[model samples]
Target: MKQSNRKVSGTLRVWSGVVAATLLAGCGGAEPVHPDEPFPQTQEQAQENVAAAPIVESMDAIALDRTLTSRTRSLIRARLAQGQAQVHQQVPVVSDSGQQLFLNDQGLNGDVTAGDGLFSAIGDVDFVTHQATQDRIREFQARNPQRPLMASTFDNRVRVSTRPLTALSPSVFQPGVPIPIFPAGITFAVKPANSLIITDASVINDPTRTYDPCSNSGNPNGVWTFNHLMREMANTYVSPSVLTEHWLRQWTVNQNINGWTVPARTAMMPYILTPWPRVGGALDLTRSPFKLVAIVNRLDLGGGRGPAGYASGNAGELRFVFAAVDRTSGTCGVRPFLVIFEYGVPHSSCDAVKTWAQRWLELSAPSMVLGSSAYNAALASLTQQVVVRNAAPRKPNGSAINQIRTNEEWLRYPWELREFHLMGSGPSVNRLQGQPTVLTPGDAHNDTPVLRDFINANTPAILANTYTVPTTFPTASTPFLGAFPWIASDTTSFWRATGISVNEARHKFSLNTCSGCHGRETKTGFTHIDEFGTLSPFLATGMSDPSIAYVVQDPVNTSLNREFFEIEMRASKLDSLANQSCLASAFHRRLTSAH
Candidate 1:
């Protein structure tokens, strides 16, 4: 880490390279090793060998496909069935930097059996390209200042979706999780009147306020126009009065719009909402809003409580994901915010929820006119039957209402508390709560001392089970991360969830947070998806380029990437999940049609 140490390591590495070359040349006219390289000198070759690290090169160390989780196997089968997702990998075993060990089904790439589902790739690790990789080489030289050369393995991370990068789409053939609102006859932009931009105070009240699409609906087919539906969802903020107070007046909603200077619109509109894709219990529960947000799948929770919380995880949910945005209007000031509305499927049934999601998919298709009488009829069923449960955001004293303060997965937080989050642990989701719940000057814009303490304490324990889905064994001090990338110092460990380093795991989790993802930590500006159908460079580029050498640059730190393509991953997982079969719950059971 020190300058002096780096200089000394450099010298040692050069000398070691010379010695290795001589040794190789002596091996019956083998190709001479380049003096500039110690071993594992090329990107493609380095994945197989890391002579610079203390790692032992054991091809068998990683397992076969048979070791895959039931969900993983099913996802793979689904991909294969769809005519795409032909990638075969054993361990997405990536390095601390970002090179992945490319296992293969082809016999040419270290595969013993070419046709079997199991994949194998030999670490021809002959070079290093990343800082993490170079650091390990230097560390090895320091440990063995004057030693013989040996072989090793590589690693990288961010428990990314293992499926091939599928493009985002609604058709069953091209499945993905988040459906970009563009072109859809829905409220795609985040602006007043034009779209649904959530804020604290209201300014331009719609001339036509239809709160419930089903109420006094004269349509023979029972549907409301898409514009009418958007207006209705927006009116709920000011309509029925009581909800207007609890849902929009406080917490981040307040900070979100607090300092706006617009003459009439006091509230600084910040969020753009989009629906996640899936039907018949098929939405991918491994991405944002579901995997990393406030309300999450039990598998995403950590500590012993994940299982406990998940035991009752059966309700169907309709998620409306919100991304914080900055408008060019007025002072142009808006608190960074990321919020989601997980609507309980009508009648709380998964089957009905499937229909709810299916209808949304139909509405999103650009071919159909939202104002058509037919579309309106389809919209009527969900709007009239929907209910905002008592479990919704904000309550008296800016406090929370949930199953239990410690265990409630659905509780929303004030701006100060929900700024950052730690997932997969007890209480499953940990909000970045300050010591004494302060609401005065909102948006710390960084990881508070409280959150730092929590992450610093628990990361090592997370590494202990790196080869498996990370479920930190409830350590008091959890792994901490923020604007800057933080590695747990445990190099050899790999998180089974993504086959990446503990460091990358941190990157992925932090990248999902409202603050971490939007700020400098991810080199993101304004919104990932902005008003007027524009995308931040990070989201636009990252989604398409999986092997791009871009680093994760957020507010504080920078991290390397292995397989962190956001939308691609979410879409891939959604596709796999959508294709996997699920047992129906009494296909003919009497189900409540409406609330």
Candidate 2:
């Protein structure tokens, strides 16, 4: 399952020397400067800056190294490529006691190990209140048996509104203003079905149970238990520092107000803000520019292979699934399982996420948040950043930012396998007895698996139109396109490390997935918060009114940052109400507590 350290060469060995000579000649004898050091004073020195500058006419040695490695990844490509060879890859597993287990294709097991960062120090909490807050979640869950799972209890009372681009951000993306992420008139359901949301408290509280097949009256393919949902919420919405620091003081000595134990404060404090009054309004998720996203994490059913095997039986396995619902054609939907680390743990786990954040925001100088522009810039500059690796031998840890790959493994399910499943014509094509066969032919190399599955699962009437894969990156023109382009762009480093081709690397690095669409250039060192707020529930007339308002921050109209905070705050409150827990109060205290 491990990569062979042995190095090999083909046409790349000759090109490596040629590239090095070209880069050296282009450098014009310019000496490399450390990113932290002062700039050279002379004009000559300044002229030499081209060596380290972003614009390079020739590939440098470092670039050459990446190039060589990318091309040399025969071993890597073989592992990641299609065919039976993948069956021997390691499967990640987590035990009931929070132990990690790795099983290979033959079901041979590997020892449990922790990666670098905070995961290696699992039980340590930088903040005392943090531990108390976790304790409170347990207590709250124990007391509120009737409380619905947080995932299922979504509120539809709040209305959605479109704010002008000028109002959203006067600083940048101006002039042609109001480029909202979604087009106007789209709304979301108040709440989806329990089956769709997977919000049952018992299922969430009990991590040991296996999810049954949909045919056996169990939840369908992609489902998220409360545990994973909360972890993701914290990973995205809560700052790592907030999770690891502040409020975590010794239990309030006298259980005093303003200095009370989290539980005591929760019991004593009225909700920080009253719930917004019900408003009769709805939003459509299928409308223009609005995309339906579904993320599901399932216990990996290992097909009864070995000690770690859970497939064939409804046992909790380790796997994660993601899909972008294409309501447009109704024929093709795109679903991708987490590619790396067969077991969900250490990659999708809350502890691992926090640790990754810590490395990005705490352990390093001038720390930054995962999606922040500064973080992106840091990754782009090799000299300015610290060295980090994906997956094991380096550290089995995965970052929340690297959504494309959990660790060393590409973070998505193999395209070939997914396509085969959808076609109902690949390896397991005969597995279906009554399920509809594919109505449209799917390209094994190009078509996405989820889109294929959608066609096979739905009737030709429901899936009226045939879906084609997108030809251009980031275009919304096609409904059933695979996400390989996005994934490739996101994982350029992995591709580079594996020595992929220049064309492949270009595809991986060229597209700017997040900030490219939401760029805000006029702001001064503004992070993600500076982006324009196009459509927000908080900006709506109903949610912003103080009398029944749910948003705690003052509405800026132009800043998505304000809108994001409000939504985070609201989600916290909803989390409390849904789980019948006091996490909202604890979270608030954690945010505000000086101790």
Choose the strongest candidate by TM-score. Answer: 1
Q: Which stretches of candidate 1 lie over 4 Å from their true place?
A: 1-239, 246-357, 360-385, 388-453, 460-502, 526-559, 572-579, 583-595
* lDDT (tens digit, per residue) of candidate 1 on 514-573: 344444444555344332233455545533432233445322223433333432222222
lDDT of 2 by residue, 207-303 (tens): 2221221112222111232122212322333432222111111111222211111112221111111111112331111111111121212212111
The local lDDT score (0 to 100) that residue 466 gets in candidate 2 is 15
Using lDDT as the measure, the top candidate is: 1
- Give the TM-score comparing model 1 with the true structure, all chains together: 0.34
Global lDDT of model 1: 0.25
Candidate 2 C-alpha error for residue 541, in Å: 10
lDDT, candidate 1, at 395: 22
